[model samples]
Target: MTQPRIVLYSALLCPFAHRARIALKASGAVYETVEIDLKNKPAWYAPNINPASKVPAISYGAPPDSDVTKPPAGTFLLPESALVVQFIASLYPQIDYKDPIIRAKASFAQLQWDNLVAGRWRKYQFEGSEQDLEPLLEGLKQFSDSVPEEILGDEYGVADIILGPFVTRLFIFANEDIGKWAPGSGPKLVSALSGPEYDKLRKLGAKLDKWPALQETIDNDILVKKFTEILKNH
Candidate 1:
């Protein structure tokens, strides 16, 4: 079977873009990547590729071009990380959900995490106070407990791909660097999240350690360094 031609527009440091990239890789589909500079987006990118001018946009089943409004016949343009990941998963049989019910459940779970848990983490990371740490810790514990033992039994699927990137960032960067970046509140926040009270969350962290695809996605040294630099400046 001929593989669909895919071009991924992405920035390495964006976790959302990273999620789409992971899905693409795990699908075992051959696709080209065009890294976009988020700081200085090209003039043609917004008009031609994605109106939102975001990384992790994809042009499917066709070569990349300057048509902004729509893709060529036999192809389509998809933006947004979660939607792009779902589209690729559906297109390729290799990484698709084994059961429709499970797919629905996982999709719903992913949405909840994205909207609620991830939002809380972001709030704690950027504008959290000492009083805010307890809620964030509680949220992390709830999130970890809510996740299925493997999410899809023995197979890696969409839900894992969707949440894996942000989970990695939270444990690695947020836990470690929050103190240095945010001062007094930082260390306390990290301790509360990673401390004994949240061992379930730590166990979830261990699961991510064993996920090879996630490791590959989050282990980029250059990406990590760049993200750390950004956080330090934040």
Candidate 2:
């Protein structure tokens, strides 16, 4: 079967969009990336594509439109980065989604990480206050303790996918700026998430050697790039 032609509408600075890129790359999906200038969105981005005018929208084609749902030719448009990533995973189950039950469980884990942990992490990243990360880290510690190990048993799943980027960033920022402020926070975060199965995941995340796909993005440069674009104008 021919590979699917996927066009991902993305911004380098958006972590949400990065999730889509990671999913596609990790799943081995053949995709073309369209970098959107989020500061000044393109003319085609409105009602024609995504009504929400968000980055990480997607248009997928080819593979002869299997039993699965597919978008109309040139009419394909999907918004929301998380959903787009999940949809791509669903398309290539062998690479990403695996089984229906496993997929569902992974999806739930992704949702929990996104809505709970990620949301809290963002509150710290943007706020310019080290104090805020404390409560969030505590919450994470509690979460790690409570969540069953069986949830992350023996395999990488949506939990790792969803949490990897931010956790990586947290590890980075904490080491750089806040590690001394909260000495145990960074190590605790790492230990909580990095089990034996997630060993590969830990390396994939914050390795001194940059992940090939993200080399152009720099070492934690998204934060700088985004702040430069958004904050400079404002």
Among these predicted structures, which one has the highest lDDT? 1
Q: Which residue pairs in candidate 1 have backbone atoms (N, alpha carbon, C) closer than 3 angstroms, thus clashing? A: none
**Cα RMSD, model 1:** 3.3
Candidate 2, which segments miss by more than 4 Å at Cα? 62-74, 97-105, 128-131, 146-155, 178-234
Residues 100-196, model 1: lDDT tens digits: 7777766766665766677777777766655666676667766655565546355778877888787777766654564233455655555766666
Give per-residue lDDT, candidate 2, residue 226: 53
- Report every candidate's CA lDDT: 0.72, 0.60
Error of 1 at 46 (Å): 0.7
Best by TM-score: 1
Instruction: Give, for candidate 1, the lowest lDDT window spanning 10 residues.
Output: 175-184
Give the per-residue lDDT digits (tens) of candidate 2, residues 39-151: 89877676556878887788767344431223455555789876886787688664464566766655665555656667676665445356776667665554444333443
